[model samples]
Target: MVVDLVVIGTAITLGPLHNSAFILLLTAERGVRRGLVFILSWLAGLLMVIAAVILLTGGTPPARQSVPSTAALAGKLALGLGLVAYGERKRRRPPRPRHAPKWMERPDRVSGWTAAGLAILLQPWAMVGAGAATAVDANLSSIASTLALTGFCVLATSSMLAMELYTTFSPVAAEAKLRGLRDWLDTHQDQAIVSLSLLLGLWLVADSIYQLVE
Candidate 1:
């Protein structure tokens, strides 16, 4: 479970879309406040998913080979397959011209509420769903299980959190560096998406099959 969550969380944090949007938030007017809001909103969404899973599982791993356990694994299998297919399609398609979304056009003018909403909107939800599915195995009564979930949340949000703090402390340097990072991300966005989707999807699929047959 910990390993699965770590992989999923890394995929989530490495997503180019949200990270690009976050850079915009950091460079906006009153960026510190907006960036904080974005992080809080992003964290809230992750917590909600994990919380719902914990509630359903009641802090216990479902009995292996039971209906609930099978269902959870099956859900992950389906999601994994979906990601694999999506990633393959992207990989085979010709690279198209990329343009910034209209919402990103005026990030400097984005309101606090808009920033929060963007945080929610920009989540790599497919990967987030994978995280939630993997989290179903969390046995919260165990210290390790509890820590794994906490670590997943922290790891998933680490990028945005790092940026917010970096900007707050060193606005001058952070601006140039973050902007450069954003440009690079935009240029390589498709490759990044394809790589993360295929690699993580294959991991989940292989793991799910192993668990099912074991």
Candidate 2:
């Protein structure tokens, strides 16, 4: 469970879409406030999912080979296969001219509420689902299990937290660097998505299969 959380957390942190959106928010007018709104919303979404799963399971994993256990693994398997298919399709499709979304162009105009909405909208939900599925195995009675879930949330949100803090403290410096990063992410977003999807998909697929068989 710890291993799964680490991998999924890393993937979420490094995801192109949210990071790109976040960079725009950070560099926009009133960016620090907007960025804070985004980070809080993003963290809230993750917490909600994790809390829901823990509640449903009574904070203990369903027994191995039990129906609930099998179902969780199967759900993860399906999600993994879906990601793999999506990645392959993107990889095989003919390249087209990529343009930044219009919304990205006017980050300065985005309201705090809208920035909050973007956070919810831009989450890598498939990966978040995978994380929730892994959290199924969490035995919260154990300090490690509890800490793992808490740690996973922090780790996943760390990137945005760091960016927001940097921008808040050193606006002039962060703006130039963050804009450069945003442009790079925009240019390479598709490639990043494809790579992340395949790598994480394969990992989830293999791990799910191994657990199911064991």
Candidate 3:
């Protein structure tokens, strides 16, 4: 239970903090409400993945048990390559034109609930990781473990909500920071994405190789 809580908490924190999906969403959207909405959409997407994983793997061994196999290693390598390729593609793409919608330009027109729900749904990796962790804990048939998993999810979500609120309210700071980032991205988007993708791919390859060796 303790282990499950720690793992899940870490996954949730990392997902919101450094996940490319969240960063891309923030980069694309300028307003606080939109940013929140994007996150909610991401979360909602994640929930769908979670539900699917739970339903499919409910009676199966944990992913850790399955992912260390030769087949899994190959799949991970493929996934790593795919991620690298995706990042490279993003880098090569031209900048999109910005056109503000009438609704988006109005501060009072945004829907908070919708945004929250959507953000929760869209981040599929976070959802799957959290769900898998929760499932493993649940399989232990310990009420304490279950409670801890739930607590971790709630705490992580709360932390994200707080951060989003702070970011949204600080328009001047947020805009300034985003403007600087945008300019940087425009000049070095491909290099940045490719570098990150390569690093992540290397990590994946190393992990897979270690699993095979072990």
Cα RMSD for predicted model 3: 6.6
The lowest-lDDT stretch of 10 consecutive residues in candidate 3 is 15-24
Off by over 4 Å in 1: none
Q: Number of clashes in model 1?
A: 0
Per-residue lDDT of 17-77 in model 1, one digit per residue for the tens?
Answer: 9999999889878889999999999999999999999899998889999999999999999
Between which residue pairs do clashes occur in model 1?
none
Q: What TM-score would each prediction reach against the true structure?
A: 0.97, 0.97, 0.52
lDDT of 3 by residue, 6-99 (tens): 5434445444223333333443445555666765655455445445544654634355546423554566556556656776676677766655
State which candidate has the highest lDDT: 2
Better-scoring candidate (TM-score), 2 or 3: 2
Kindly report which residue stretches of model 3 are placed more than 4 angstroms away from their true locations once superposed.
1-30, 59-71, 84-163
| Sort by lDDT, top down from the best | 2, 1, 3
- Candidates by TM-score, descending order: 1, 2, 3
Worst 10 residues of 1 by lDDT: 98-107
Candidate 1 residue 48 Cα shift, in angstroms, is: 0.5
lDDT of candidates 1 onward, in order? 0.91, 0.93, 0.50
Query: Candidate 1 lDDT (Cα, whole model)?
Result: 0.91
